[model samples]
Target: MFNDGAFAQITKRDKRDAMLINLVHGEPIRFGVDNERGVAMDSSGRIELVDVVDVGVENLLVHDETADDPSVAFAISRLATAPTMPTPVGVFRAVERTEYAAAVSDQVDAVTASQGAGTLEGLFASRPTWTVS
Candidate 1:
């Protein structure tokens, strides 16, 4: 929890119930707020809403306990030393196809090739001249 407030101010109604929730903590945190200050309960229970002007919270509130690691500090400490994912590299390769029709024969043969044999080296004894990157 932050030093200034155990709860972050969500909404405030003048002389009425102020809606507030607990900050992240290792304990099971429940919150109750007085117009003057905020209060926290470590044991699991419903959130307490006391009216600064009225009696209780007007809005329906539900609380759920998650299965996440209770220690936020420990989780952050582990993340600090975790390895980052590797950057992705781009790949480019040329397409080659046989011409089925007579008209496109010249165009198919003209499909350009470049210098180096990449993965195609086994198929072509000569330098595989299809452009690849």
Candidate 2:
């Protein structure tokens, strides 16, 4: 659980209902909006029907339940910054990191802020990325 209204995940199983999942530490510790069905705007002066919105990997965050020590935090951070990932879409790497240090609430504002634009980009994070390989 991130203070950014982003949910934490130790495994891919935790992302069953996530939307617009952003990379916090990597892909394990995901922070995204909860899934919803509806219409939305496209940032411009246009209305766009939406089902999902994707996020940049710059916010990658890998989850670590036992990250109670400096070594663990370092290790997890290393994983997030790792050069290569065995992804289904082929190899991938976290390009950059988004600095997120703030308070969150029970409302969707935290989740919306995580998307940077407050749009329905969170639902776009719901796409299943990794798989057991």
Candidate 3:
């Protein structure tokens, strides 16, 4: 478990450093620390307590209603189906990294084909911008 202040600081730094990405049709999304702890951060930089055990990757799914648009449905769907587990930090990070890898894979085919090489660097370059706790 993370100390409250430590967790808050980590999440805040992550949120602050997150690279905002435009979803197809919803509000821009940024990668950051999320846990059973209610999305990890409040607008005021406070960490909200939550039932971590219940917060699975599925809960991070952004629905049309929550997203307020249809354009992002596909992306949200992809995110919804991403891997998730019941552990504290490692589980979420693994799921997120998996999702990030998949996202990068979508763009890697061309790079690998053109370069005639598939490397970790090439693959990582295609992943979503994110930070780990």
Give stretches of model 1 more than 4 Å off: 1-9, 13-18, 34-133
Top TM-score model: 1
Clashes of each: 0, 21, 1
Q: What tens digits encode model 1's per-residue C-alpha lDDT throughout 1-133?
A: 4665322233334312333333343222223434332222224532332332332322322222242333432322232131221111111112244556854755545553443334555557665468778
Candidate 1: worst-modelled 10 consecutive residues by lDDT? 85-94
Q: How much is the lDDT of residue 26 in candidate 1?
A: 29
Query: What is the C-alpha lDDT profile of model 2 across 8-45, one tens digit per residue?
Result: 33234554333222323324333324433222233552
C-alpha-based local distance difference test score of model 1: 0.32
Give the lowest summed-lDDT range of ten residues in model 3.
Answer: 86-95
Ranking by lDDT: 3, 2, 1
TM-score on alpha carbons, each prediction: 0.19, 0.16, 0.18
| Alpha carbon deviation, residue 127, candidate 1 (Å) | 23
Residue 11 lDDT in candidate 2:
35
Model-by-model lDDT, in order? 0.32, 0.35, 0.37
| Model 3, global lDDT | 0.37
